[model samples]
Structure formats: structure tokens, C-alpha cells
Target: MTVQTTPAGTPMPDTMEPEDDDVKIIADIDEPWLPSILTIETGLPTMGVALGAGLLGVSVNSGRGPLVAFMIGLFSAVLVFLAVIDWKTYRLPDAIVLPLYPALGLAVAAGVAVGAITPTAALTAVISMTAVFVILWLIAFFTGGLGFGDVKLGGLLALVCGLESGYAAALGALILPMILGGLVALPLLFAGRRKHEFAFGPYMVAGALLILLLPNVLVPISRGSLFH
Candidate 1:
């Protein structure tokens, strides 16, 4: 049998994987339009995410400045991209998450070099990394709901958030995942589903970002009995 041709004049091979169509169509879509739509639809949340991530990073670094905040925002965007890819594939490949640890150390060192991160803050950042990693791993083991990737990712985040907010950073990191999971799960549960599987990183990112940007609200609420 002969293959069919798309309206755009591209011929579809008979044995092409089904996913190829979506990939092709997505690429064929205009590039400029994506940024435009992302800004339009996700504008507020994107900005919030960026600001939050940066603030937490700066706080841990003990360096608060527009530049640091901008870096946080940029990294937040990258985190979003990584999380989305992982959610789709269910694989948080170390190729993306691993290097971030040492790179974060460098960023912290850079902040120190520039006098953004004081010696005290730098020390805190180091301690935060170890503490968050151990804590998250324990939670993951007991619940069986979290993965090694989550624990690893949480460590990297601690350098940014834990150093910044101290104990608050840890609180935000832990509570946000449960909240996001609940938000996603409650609807499903009400519909009578008992157990379900979700990627969960996005919600963690959301909680972290919220704590970074709007801790005044999120921290209090997270500590409250919102779930009850």
C-alpha cells in the first residue's frame, strides 16, 4: 500500500512511528507563537515561579539582588522544562539533574566571591544540602510514593531554598508536594479512584516556587490545616 501525504506537502512514510506526527506538527508550528502563548497563558504563574525560585536561591546564598532573582527565574523555567519532560517520560535522567548540584555549589561560591553570600550563608547552604537529602530519602522510603530522583532533586533545591529560608525552606519543600498531590488526587479520589500514579515533580516545583516568591502566604497556609 502507498503512503499518504500531509497537506503541508510532507509525505508520511508507511512505517513511521505514530508519535512522529505530533512531533512533526509541533515543530511545524511557529516558534515565536510558543513564547507568546506561554507568556499569555502562563504569564503570571511563570513570573511567580521565576521570582520564587530566585528569591529562595538568593536567600540561601544570603545574596539578594535583581540579578540573583533573575537567575532564579531562569532556572525555574529550566526546572519547568525538565519536570514536563520527566512527567511525560517518567524518567528523571541524571543527565539533567546531577550536574545541577555542583553547579549550584559554584553558583554559591560565585555569590560568596561577590560578597552576595556571606561565609555564614555558604555554610548553611552546605548543611542544607545534606539535611534535605537525608530527610527526603527517608520520606520516600516510608511512603513508597517518592523516587530516588525526587530525593536527588530535593537536595539540589535545598541548596537554593534551605539555605535561603533555613527551616522554612525544608517545610515548603515537603509540604508543597503533598498539597499538589492532593489537589491532583482529590478530584480523582472523589470520583472513587483509590490509587493513582502521577509524576508529582511539577507540584513540588510549584510549592518550592510559591515559597520562594510568596512565602508570606504559602508558609502560613502550608503550616495550617488546609488539608483537613
Candidate 2:
């Protein structure tokens, strides 16, 4: 049967019109309010994390490259969102990840053009991501530190971090959560826990936030100029 394709929101043709048997009509529809609610509900937490990380980076870096750090944090937030959704729903849809590539690329290019990020710093960022993923992936494989979702998330995180502060920042982000997880899990383990599986997405989010905001948090601890 012959079929006519109609634009979304356009009126459908009358049944009397002739149709080809081989034609297939694809219908487009708008999402209802639930999607908006879900997006807001999901996006708000990620935004909060991003903002917090940005402030932290500004403080630690002495406000040298706050925008670059903020952009990195924002990109990390997308990875965090994907990981969280996958943890909850067991699927990481392309809708959450594809848009981030362009954002990261543009942010990096802009930062470099503006001298907000040095080319050397950008190279370090790449190394930082690579070291973290390779080391973590090996550990996770041998010790089950994480799963495939985390592996993919780590790689995504590397791209963002590589464009910002290099490997140290990424390490800071990755380590923050592990430390937090240990503190939290220690109590449970001591309380006679058995056969437990902790949700890791939250920690990954925390780590990224720590990396983003390290300038603020690290200043007091480091108590001096950044070395190297």
C-alpha cells in the first residue's frame, strides 16, 4: 500500500487516498511532560555538582583558569549522569553522551584560543585520562573495582579532564570518591556486613566534583604554590 509521510503536528490524510503496500509511514511525536520532569529531576543534581566543582577549581587555581575547570566539570557531569542512569536503568542512551563531545571540543578550543588553557596543559589532560583509565581498568578487571559502565564513564571523564588540568585533576576526582566510599563502607563493614555491592555512580560524581573544585579544597591542604 502507498503511504504518505506527514510532518509532525500536521493532519493525517483521509483513508480514501491510495497507498502503496511497500511504503511505511513513520510518525513523529513530541514527548509529554514526564520527560521534562525526568530531565529536570536528573539534570538538577548534575548542575549542582558542576557548580560546586567550578567554585572549587577557581579557589585552588587562584582563579587562573576557572572557566576551563568549570567546563571540564560540566562535561564530567554528563558522564556522571550517564553512569547514574545506567546504574538505575541498566542502559546508557546516546541522548546523554553524544552532545557532550562537541561541547568538550568547543570548550577546549575556546580555552586554548583565549590562553585560558595552555597547549601543554591540554596534553597533560590527555595523559591524565589515559593513565587513570588504563590503571583503573586493569584493577577493575583483576579486583572488580568497577564494571563496563564505569570503564566507559572513566573514558568519558578522561576527555573532559584532559582538556582541563591534565592527569592530576582526574586523579583527584577519581580518588575523592574512593576515599569517600571507604569511609562510608568501613562503617557498614564493621557493623557485620556481608555480600554487599555498593552503587558507584554516586562516588564517580563525587570524584568529578572534587576534581572540579580542587583548587578551593586543596589550597588549605597544600598551603603553597602548585608544584610542576
Candidate 3:
């Protein structure tokens, strides 16, 4: 009789726990109380994940100029991680989601400090976050279909999208998610999973990433690009 342990050496109960080979643990930190701990045993290689994320990040904002694109790229990479974990667990841990509040603000601040981003853009980002958060908060309160996690993630996505364009893009980010989520959900509903809960973070991330990558897309639709 042998006991198995995670690659990180966390114990796995043979009777009650998944097999050691079945999961890879991702901890942004090893702290037990942190929400960054993610145990996903999908048989995917670590290097593969990193490679894919890097490609996605680069592709997402490569047109935003070097500095902005680089930072957005890094954040997009993180979004990839969050998207997968949220899909698998149906929960977006606070460890990753919570920090984006400060991290995104700081990134905007850094941009302003260097003159890459204007103060006006920074303010727009803040407004974007607040607006999305408020709207989603109200939706979650009224509909009971959205969770706090979705609300927070939606706001962060708006923050980045706002930075990329303006308040209009941020608003577009919210709409895109709803549209995309509905597209994904309609089929499931027809398939008879009406009460089924699905992960919404991935669509949120996709909307933000698309907003950043395709800055020209919503330009005519947005009417005025404040940050651009």
C-alpha cells in the first residue's frame, strides 16, 4: 500500500483523493489561505501551458505599442490561467482575481508616470471598472445567475479594455461577454441543461482580450476613442 503525493508534495489520499498522476497543482504562492492554489490534473504539460499563454498574450495586444502591449500581454497570460481554472472548478479564486484590482491600477499608474498613458486614460480605466462592477453587481443581485466572482472578473476586464480605448470600449467589453455567453449558453439550453451553471470568466477574458487586440474593431461602433 503506497500513498501518493502531488508533484508539490501535498498528500493525496488514495481512497479519497485523485490519483497523483491526474492533477498538477498551480500555486502562485504556497500559502494555504491564498486563493491562488489551483489543483488541475488534466494531463497537460506545464511548459505547454506557458508556451500557449505566451503566444496568446503576445497576440492579444501586440498592436498596442511596446510598453502597453507588453504589460497587457503579461496580464493576458494570467487570464489564460484563470480562465482554465474557472472552467474546471467553476470558481475563480480570490488569490488571482482579487489582486488584479491593484495590479491593473498600478499598471495604469505606471503608464501615466512614463507618459505612455495619459491621466485621462487612467481615470477612464477607473470609471470602466466601477461601471462594470456596478452593473454586474446589480445583475447578480437581481437575477441570481451571476456570482460575485463573475462581477469582479467583469470589472477587471473592463478596466483593461478601458485603458485600451475609452469608456465606450469598456462598455463594449461588457456587451461582448453577454453576447458571447449567450451564444455559448443557447446551445446548452437547447440540449436541456437549463439549470446548468457554466463558467463565465472565459467569455469575459475573451471579450477583454479581443477588445485589446482589435482596437480598430469597435472604433466606428464606439464613435469616439478617448484613450487611443
Q: Candidate 2: misplaced stretches above 4 Å?
A: 1-70, 76-102, 158-167, 190-194, 219-228
The worst-scoring run of ten residues by lDDT in candidate 1 lies at: 25-34
The list of candidate 3 runs beyond 4 A from truth reads 1-65, 218-228
| Candidate 1 per-residue C-alpha lDDT over 1-228 given as tens digits, one digit per residue, 9 for 90 to 100 | 355556666766656744445323223322232343255456556556545565565454333765455556556666765565455555566777898887778877887888766788778767877888899899889987788888888877677766456665676566666777788878987988767666777777766666666545555665684455
- lDDT for each residue of candidate 2 in 116-188, tens digit (9 for 90 to 100): 9888876776676667778678877998857655655565566664554554455554766577668877887
**RMSD, every candidate, angstroms:** 7.8, 9.2, 8.1
Compute the lDDT of residue 15 as modeled in candidate 3.
Answer: 54
Counted clashes in each candidate structure? 4, 12, 2
Query: In terms of lDDT, which candidate is stronger, 1 or 2?
Result: 1
| TM-score per candidate, chains pooled | 0.64, 0.59, 0.72
How many clashing residue pairs are found in candidate 2? 12
Residue range with the least summed lDDT across 10 consecutive positions in model 2: 28-37
Q: CA lDDT of each candidate?
A: 0.66, 0.59, 0.72
Top-lDDT structure, candidate number: 3
